[model samples]
Target: MNEPGGSGGAEGVRLQKVLAGAGLGSRRACEELIAQGRVQVDGEVVREQGMRVDPTTVVLHVDGMRVQLDPDLVTIALHKPKGVVSSMHDEKGRPDLSGLVADRRVFHVGRLDADSEGLLLLTNDGELAHRLAHPSYEVTKTYVVTVEGRVKPGVGQALKRGIELDDGPVRVDAYTVLETSPRRSLVQVDLHEGRNRIVRRMFDAVGHPVTRLVRTRIGPVRLGQLKPGQTRVVAGNELGALMAAVDL
Candidate 1:
């Protein structure tokens, strides 16, 4: 019904082609999905054989999942190394996030201070970036920390119970001691708080000052085998789960 008596042919690309190009499937398979009334454009199901859509301007959903088609939009995951600033431009002239993604006009989704490093995402998609970075969204981040002196099991328990900070009480969603020795300890922590230098401050407050910190995970994305100072495009299942996380 969206074909509009063949006027759709004069403008926009074919819907099935757009879907297939989006990695949904082959053209025939996308056509089958459209015929099954599972392809939607701007919230309306289109069952026409040759429905055309301006992908950049239309919200396309297949089987209730969004399909991003704007070629201008991108999201990149960077394993930021220590000493690199998260800002796109640094007046201090130190290496920055923009140099890492020189090809894309994007900004870092969240800040990873120069002292700490791990999975950092940069994106030109404003909505996706806002949703991922906003405090209203309870997206947990996992950090592996090394601190002075051995951390006891009690500290982990106390963290879960919540610790009082200058601003307010801070609590971890999860914490585990990965290693402990006489001089130093290693631990993994998960929290949703995005306050400035929060993890370090929390450990300091508990008497185990953090010596090293690396954020290992942010929601569905992982650092994995990505070495320091490397980046990969965020797409496919990972992208799907991310958008699903923030209701994009």
Candidate 2:
């Protein structure tokens, strides 16, 4: 196997050493992976050794999946509780996501209203956060909603077909009525847009105002078994898939 090219200066960490530090394996084992051309530095496959990369600025991938090398940059999935705001700071003095990651310099990717609850991501990686929240990426957000009154037939169809909100035409990627009673109905829906109170507005338009809302998933990451106010670091293969969603 031929030696890998350098990032030109001697200022950065060695690729194999960095890989080892990232828990891939012993330094020698990481070098073997490098020798086999399984390592990619900023999208280019590199082989052999002696390549130096700035983990802070350079992107690395093994087998076409992006790897996280910077310890400072992290993404967090927080199960926001009802009445908690998504912002890091709330002047109103209510509980907010800031207390959750007070030790890290992170910002929420999107907002979950004070009344809404469920999966919300916070990260210090600006590019990843921007892409994930951008409308063009269309990262679908899944939510379970309880609405007032029984859900009438064809409401799902009407939402699937698209409803014109005051902002514009809105449509759900998927919708299912989970349960219904005379006074309340439960349903789940998927959407990519993040307009202010979009889910609540959508239901209201259909004549069923949302009584309770809880997000369950965002793209491939699920809230899972996390209870209210719980949080987990988003890492490993799950992190890779998330970055891929935004073409990072």
lDDT of each: 0.87, 0.88
lDDT of residue 183 for candidate 1? 100
Please report the candidate that would top lDDT against the real structure.
2
* Residue-level lDDT tens digits of model 1 in 141-211: 99999999988769988999999999999999999888999999999999999999999999999999988
Per-model TM-score on C-alpha atoms: 0.86, 0.87
Runs in model 1 deviating more than 4 A are: 1-12, 32-51, 62-64
Question: What is candidate 1's local distance difference test score?
Answer: 0.87
**Candidate 2: global Cα-lDDT?**
0.88
Query: Would you list the clashing residue pairs of candidate 2?
Result: none
Candidate 2 ranges beyond 4 A from true positions: 1-5, 8-14, 25-38, 47-52
How big is the RMSD of model 2? 2.9
All-Cα superposition RMSD per candidate: 3.0, 2.9
Considering summed lDDT, which 10 consecutive residues are worst modelled in model 1? Answer: 1-10
